[model samples]
Target: MTAMIKAHEIQGVIALENSFNRVGLDHVVLVKVATAGVVTRLMGGSREEVINALSNAWIDGQSLRTYRHAPNTGSRKSWAAGDATSRGVRLALIALKGEMGYPSALTARTWGFYDVLFRGNEFKFQRPYGSYVMENILFKISFPAEFHAQTAVECALQLHPRVKDRLEQIEKIEITTQESAIRIIDKKGPLYNPADRDHCIQYMTAIGLIFGELTAAHYEDSVAADPRIDVLRDKMTCIENPQYSRDYLDPSKRSISNAIQIFFKDGTSTERVEVEYPIGHRRRRKEGIPLLVKKFETNLARRFPAKQQKAVLDVFLDNRKLVGIPVNEFVDMFVI
Candidate 1:
């Protein structure tokens, strides 16, 4: 767990200033690099072996960000991180088997990663990594929407009871959000599938406003077939609030803020509902952790019998016991 957290921090801190998207590369490249470096160390590889594994990861072809954007968005965006991590392990194993690595994989003038993938710019870091990323990780507790749209969905849910029965009377729904949400999730056209819908702020807000809740199932075609969702989506517009955008990038704040207001044709409007921090934000950890534990237990019940659930929960619920258990032993407990 500690090794994994370090890996996450390495990837996240590098990503803070490195705009891979601007160069058409996916952020999962960091996942592969970080994972290969740390997993090699965890496997008891020597310093040279770790360096070799990291070089292999850098030279491994990266996935294009195209699959995560409009016109090509699909399930590949969902599985890309897993694929990167798997490749990371493969590279680490190859290094352990004595494979030689290019010492200048990242800086080899003509054919290196910096020139070929990053537009000739070297990687940048905001800070030397430690546990910052793990300590400040955001969780998607109540909604399955994109992280940038999480607060947007919360705002919509807050206004749901007032607007659910007045769908026809609503003239427009204005969504005020951070620039990141606009850049990544503000969609104006037809969404082809669940992947597209989940990434669209308008579609996610529509679901929350109409149903008073947003869930993974809500993104399915069966529920999406409901014409009312599109009706609300068609009446929606998203605008960026500069302050929200600034706060989103502020390391001290790291907020994903959003506000929603519904205007009725008759001139009355729902009070603007704003959510600065999501339920799963670190700022709300006191209120969020219990819900997170409940969610975990509920998920466990879906896959395990009652006795098995209790057995697993016994160790998991006890922090000392959970952390003290050997990795292999802990993994074996879930094998059944």
Candidate 2:
């Protein structure tokens, strides 16, 4: 059902045609629009009501780009999607009560989403709303790092065994990645908070090399206080790979690639290791899904007794049982 919902969105009328970040808007605006349409229908609204709710979502959506990166990055990046979706539900509920929607919410000359937020550019679509995005959405199953830097972290982890014993002897660490990563996660200087640290490519790579793994715990102040992370970060350099950038934005390929190479003070260098795709890519679903399930079970086990955990895990593990259960009923099973 989640995949079904996402498919409906990515293939729907209003789709991600233009780059929201390039226009200074947060892409989560799409989430608000998409969620409004789905939630309105779920609440038994007619097609007209759903349209009204969706229009309102567009009219009300803010760019929220500041919360996504740099000096202003904070816990809000973690909650922005929830915020957008929640706002969508509220808008949909209001529209159900007869709140009107702007007929020209997207094209009203000076006051429309296109003119105001998109600089007069119309929304575009590559394909119809469908299950494709759901089938192909990237997941950060192997590391807690940002999706853009997932492969970089993997690349760094590969180089860890060689560099772990010679940290002080390393003179430089070069990381080459797609341009989107450089635009989104490349960071230097002091990171102010956990959100800031987790999103930094340099920070993620350094931690992966130093600790051999990156978990949520590694983003904490306690772990970050290890001076070696910043020391390594200072020695690291990040640049864009044109081929990677092209493949990342290509409609068909959509690969996220990163290569890490470390140079030692004694003029020795580690082999340059490149990871073209993170484990969670659709291309590697067979390899990724099991690990993703294990990750889910591990997190679930930390909260519940073994018997209860297995019971819950069993419900999820069985697709037939899981899909047949109502949403409310499934959620009730996790109630403390």
Candidate 3:
């Protein structure tokens, strides 16, 4: 799909000015819209059919707010984007079979998506579609936590060595993050499962500080049963730092900064540690890419023999060999 359009098209969607989540909608609707247009065109649909397919994508998108946020964050948050993409492909397939589309699906009177879903405001764009999103994509490199809280986990890891020996002596812990982190992951109270724990900033920080590292297993029930985690969560306070919030959305400096400080029961405190951009941020690409490659190598090594792993890694490590390969052929390399 990316190969079919100019990078600007992807950039345009990334730069969308409106917050769909703010209005009780999942941003994955963009995925559906993009997929529908691309799939329809790939299926040799007429221009009108492509438009119709996109309109249907909008009309069918679920707000999906509860699955990700609110009092019941769950596993569905991980599946929602895939569901949207599947629906888009299905809609495109249906459109290819001569199905009629609602010409005014988005603009129709009171029943339109604008009036019904968007509270009467039409969709708005921040820039023309481009590949900026592809180029600056946030990689959830080491931690399995939410993207906004990744830096917080790094901060916790940095503070882990000093705080490990004084867990019970700690009085309170302070976490400062951008507004988006507060909005998406500043969770409190009981977290029921891995899905919930992974999204909770306090849980991630607490576990990182105590364990000296965090992994998928840390969010599991067995690991979460450690009473020390809940103890730390109870003593933690999270707040929005306006500067971090401002810098987070800055186009030139898309930093996901987080700060952590701890006060002991005694009259002592750890030096306030702050990390501006996570290792996954584009700004850290030089340092991050090697780690990403190592991560890929590690995962591949776990699944395949060294010989097979080397064969697979060779294809991915070489840009010249990978550039013009057919998509099907590339995927077939991993068929085993």
lDDT scores of the candidates, listed in order: 0.91, 0.86, 0.84
Residue lDDT tens for model 2, 126-209: 777666676677777999888989999999888889989999999999999999899898898999889999989999999999
Off by over 4 Å in 3: 4-15, 61-63
Please, what are the lDDT tens digits per residue for candidate 1 over residues 33-127?
A: 99899999999999999999999999988999887778777989899999999999999999999998889999989899998888888987778
Candidate with maximal TM-score: 1
List runs of model 2 lying over 4 Å from the truth. Answer: 2-8, 11-16, 61-63
Better structure of 1 and 2 per lDDT? 1
**Residue-by-residue lDDT tens digits, candidate 3, 79-181:** 8878877888998888888777888998999989888888888777755666767777777788888888899999999999999999999999999999989
Model 1 Cα displacement at 169 (Å)? 1.0
Per-candidate TM equals 0.97, 0.95, 0.94
Between prediction 2 and prediction 3, the one with superior lDDT is 2
Predicted structure 3, TM vs. truth: 0.94
> lDDT score, residue 321, model 3?
75
- Order of candidate numbers by TM-score, starting with the best: 1, 2, 3
